[model samples]
Target chain A: MSQIIKQEKKRSFVTAPTAALLSLLLPGLGQILARRVQRGLLMFGALVSIVGLLVWRITLLGRLAEGFWPTLFKSLDRAPMFVAFGLLAIAGLWLWIVIDAAKQTNPNRQFGNSIFVLILVVFFTIGWQISEIDLVKLSSDANEAWVPLSKILWPWEAAVTHDTDTVEAGAKVLVDSEGQAPPVPEKTEGEPYLRVSPRKGELSKLDEDNQVIPGTKITVYGENFEPNTRTQIWWSDSIGNEFRPRYQGEYVSVMTDSEGSFEKELIMPYRLIPPSAKGQQIHKVMARQVSQVGPPLPSQPLILTIELIIETIFMGMMATIFGIIFSVPISFLAARNLMSTSWLTLTIYYLTRTVLNIVRAIEPLIWALIAVVWVGLGPFAGIVALTIHSIAALGKLYSEAIEGINPGPIEAIQATGANKLQTIMYAVVPQMIPPFVSFTIYRWDINVRMSTVIGMVGGGGIGFLLVQYIRLLEYKSAGIAVWFIALTVAILDYVSAEIRQKFV
Target chain B: MLEIKNLTKIYPDGTLALDDVSFTVEDGEFLVVIGLSGSGKSTLLRCINRLIDPTKGQIIMDGQDITAAEPSELRRIRRKIGMIFQHFNLVDRSSVMTNVLSGKLGYINPWASLLHKYPPGAKKEAMAALEKVGITDQATKRADELSGGQRQRVGIARALMQNPSMMLADEPVASLDPVLAHTILGYLEQLNSESHISVICSLHYLDLVQRYATKVIGLRDGQVVYRGDREDIRKMTDGQFKEIYGEEAVRVNAGEFDQGEK
Candidate 1:
């Protein structure tokens, strides 16, 4: 030891200039020569990590192009300021390291390790640039999010709708009659009525190319409707499927005057009649107006959201039940304490551990995608994916619980002439109950949260509806789904916490 | 009679915990083993019931070879030889009754026991064991809810449930107070004399050993260094004490044992 110490002392006599030159070649090299090995290694690691992060950011910003130099140049071209900032920081660090290494052996050196603070500042700045953290953009572009965000924040408006009372009036028209056109319907007093000129004509039909062929022109007149009320035109085919007919890219709707009368011209809308029909087909055009609004009722989005949220809850529940059933046995196989007694058991332990780790390393969403492919899209797919992930996760947790149990009782029970299975039952199982209950509840909580997200990959739940609403820019509807998910998760967390307290 | 001939236990790590140990305990003998912490007392006790398989040994109990017993045979032999521990190892989460009942596992139907269906008489027997240990009132309580003395009493009751011919107590009173040590030993003595059950107990204090042991063996570094009967222990010399306890040990209150309160 003394001889090695003497040799180290002799090697530490390098001049300050030489030390500086050595550090200039590579950061921290001179510090190692100066006998500050730990400091030197730390400096080297910090420099490499910072440079690597900077390079990674550049590559990411460079459109992830192939090759380093091209990507770096492209990144520099795209973000000159960030590259310059990074380069300047590196230069500063390089100079500081050189200076520090030169003065490292000098007992009179005054500067504390201030380079660490500088390095931290540089790291933060690089992280800021890499993340594109822009407070200015956040403030300036608030308006774009405001439209959706405001609706999301207060979405009760979409939750309910008022019922309406409709006044209907219709007139029948003939379609390709053999002899003559049908006469106009006679009008009655004190009732809404509609009349058509030359009541019968050939109904519009699609040609071979599926283009509409305009039918004969006709004048339609309406009277005795609610005054100043908007009236919409509806057409029903021979099979009685009613739809609002479009005329020149607009619905055929008009406002009634104070006298409750109006006139409009229309072309008979195209209708498809089955070729198997044996008789002449008649089509009906109706003029409808909503005159009164009634009591409020749940909106369609609200109903659909509730239905899907229930499905999502059940998906989480079914997965958790399946997870518990499979993981309990797997956990025993995976537990090191229980399985370490023999070579065969030890192999089983390692195999179970590896399989669990591989399965758990993959996120449930990825599994959901695979499941969607296997089972097609539905809640069953979500349940399958969540169950797979939960089993792996719960298996690991339960095995850890088993490994952590007190071995004292196990020894005591074994000494009592209990069989191996009996020992586990009386000694190990008793100790494992609290941790098992706690972990199961925790896994159930995670499963519920994951079930909400798996639906985005077409696993049927509220998330499926949520993504669609988001895609369609239906923010209010999406907001309802989001609230339901958040509410369910919060409630589940509380319920699980309460249950854990009672059992664990 | 229990006879151990050429018993040796070398652990997997090559620790010679017991080396060529041999001893004999006649029926109804209250044999107390005296040794330092690592002097093979616990190992010897564990070896007798085959809790730990001896590296090499012959343990003959009433003409039966315990050391060479198969797994099923070993369990059957273990049940007849009850063992209590220093730490009072009761299943803390289980009711005291349940912990006591588990001691009867070797003799019960294995499948019925798996489903926790003890025979109708088993509970009554467990209650009787608890009554003997003076803890019948605590039968329904969780084992951990009891005091140290109470827990040890529960341990004794659990061992009693086996209806064993011989008992192994490994530093049974080491964790108890000085007074409670006598109380626990008194219970063992009563069982030894009144019920005619033999006891192989390890004790630390010389005063306690001299009071309770019908026969005594002292060990050091896994080798027996001293042997004495009740009369030899009462008149023990410092030279013999040093041979077993080493030169560094001091005999506190040498005059206390001469009085012999009983």
Candidate 2:
């Protein structure tokens, strides 16, 4: 030990100028020359990945790529400042590497110098450029963005149509007054409601008692929607409050036929009525072809945001339930102590552990894409993706729980002449229940968060709705959906923590 | 009555844990087996209940060849024989009552057992067993919530629920303190005398063996080396015990055994 310590104490020297030159050529080369292998590898990896990201973005977009290495050749004709910003970050890392390598020759010297302030300044400047930040736009153009943003947050203002935009959006109203509300096939309440076209050019919206079941599919066809515009169909309860009919997610975006007309079917989304609605099921089918010319009724956007948020929450819940179902048995198989008894069992244990690790390593987003392919693009795909991910994650936790169980009870149960199943129930299950519950709750929390983003891959959740609105720059409705996601996540986090406390 | 003509147990790994052990457990006999840790006392006790299948043996208990019994038939035989452990192996997370009621699992319908629904008659009997161990008050508490002595009492209660004709206790008092050890053995002694349930118990201390045992067997390296009645064991000298236990072994609390408690 003393000899090793003495060897470690001996100092090695490198020329500062030579080290800096090496780093100047390659971001972490000087650090490697200075015998800082880990530091060199980290710096090298970060710089390379940053450059790779820039190349990928520029090449994939093709806007700035008439040739290879556009920035190196053209110097200033980039499509977005963010690509330049990414390049700058790489340069920043390179500068840090050179400075750090030079200081390595003198172990007592600090790496940071006055140049760090310059680096910081440049970093912030690039960040601002990439973000396209404009103080003037914040004060002036904020009005245009805020009008829609505020409407999305305070939904009734933009969602409730003062005119018959819902009817004009897609529906052909064949019945009016008494015929619209009652004496139609669907269930009716006290007054008249706007009836929609159930088939092409036919307007008998009601079924038998004038009431549509929660899962009932409604078809709305309309003429004179702006040609090639995307149209949406929504449902509203008695008080003129509208909700988005998001089956899996936002009704797979129907576009109007080039003649400016559309015919589409959408399911009446479940849990559309809040408990506050007091059992009122009198619903109206309305549609709108999204046109560049006019803004939607404030209430329509507001309600759709709320509806999509709730649907995302439900999607997360379903995924968690499936996660629990699949994880429980796999956990027993995966537990080292339970499955390491014999050669056959030991082989199974390693196989189970390896498979679990592989599944867990893949992000839910990638799983969602796979799920979309397997099941088609809907909330079902989202559920399948999150459930698959959740099973692997929760299986690991449950296996840890099984491995931690006391051996005493197992022996005791066996001594009492209990069979394998009885022993597991009497001994193993009791020890496992608390941890199982805690893991399930924790998995549910994670699934909820994953489901929100899963929609981007067509997994049918609020994330799908969120990505579209963000792409269209409709920040108002987007802001409302973001609020719902934030609220749901916050609630789930609190509830899971409380549940964990109880179990633990 | 149980008869062991020639019982041998060789582990899969080739460690001979028991060899050619032969003994008869007469009706209501409190037979104490004494040996050092690796002398195969545990293997011997387990073989009777078939917890560890003997490598070769014919254990005739009440005219039935237990070694020849099928898995389902083995369970029927096991239900008649209750076993206790040194670690008081009660499920720590389950209630004391639940642990005790587990002893009745063999007799209960498998489906009902899966649902953890003990018949009302079984519940009433579990309470009676707890009363016998003087821990009826702790029945609803979790098994681990009790102190070591109390936990052992729960272990006894759980075994008592079986209403077995014979009990195999593998170093039941090994993990307890001196005072608790005697108290536990006293309960076993009382059960042996009162219910006339034959007990084949492995013990550690000389004083405990002398106090509780009606007959004694001493093992050394998987072979039975000495056999004696209560009086012969009580009169055993240090030199005589050395022959059975080996020269390296030391006696513990030997002087305490001479003065009889009862």
lDDT of 2 by residue, B1-262 (tens): 9999789999988999898999999989999999889999999998898888898879999999999999888888888888888998888878998999999988888889998888889988998888977888998998889999899888888888778889899999888777777777777878889999999999987778877899999998899988999899899887877787788767787334333232
Q: Please, what is the TM-score per model?
A: 0.81, 0.64
lDDT of 1 at B203: 87
| Model 1, span B1-262: residue lDDT tens | 9999999999988999999999999999999998888999999999999888999979999999998899999899889888889999899989999999999998898888888899999999999999988889999999999999999989989889899899999999899877777778878888899888999999888878878899999989999888889999999876777778888877643224334222
Clashes in model 1: which pairs? none
Estimate how well candidate 2 is docked, as a DockQ score: 0.51
Candidate 2 residue-wise lDDT, A132-208, digit = tens: 68888789887887676675676433344543423233223222123333223342343212244342122224457
List ranges where model 1 is wrong by over 4 Å: A1-12, A21-84, A105-111, A160-164, A170-185, A194-287, A291-299, A342-348, B70-73, B237-242, B248-262
TM-score for candidate 2: 0.64
Expressed as tens digits, the lDDT of each residue in A328-378 for candidate 1 is 999999999989998999999999999999999999999999999999999
Per-prediction DockQ:
0.64, 0.51
True contacts kept of 1: 0.74
lDDT of 2 at B152: 89
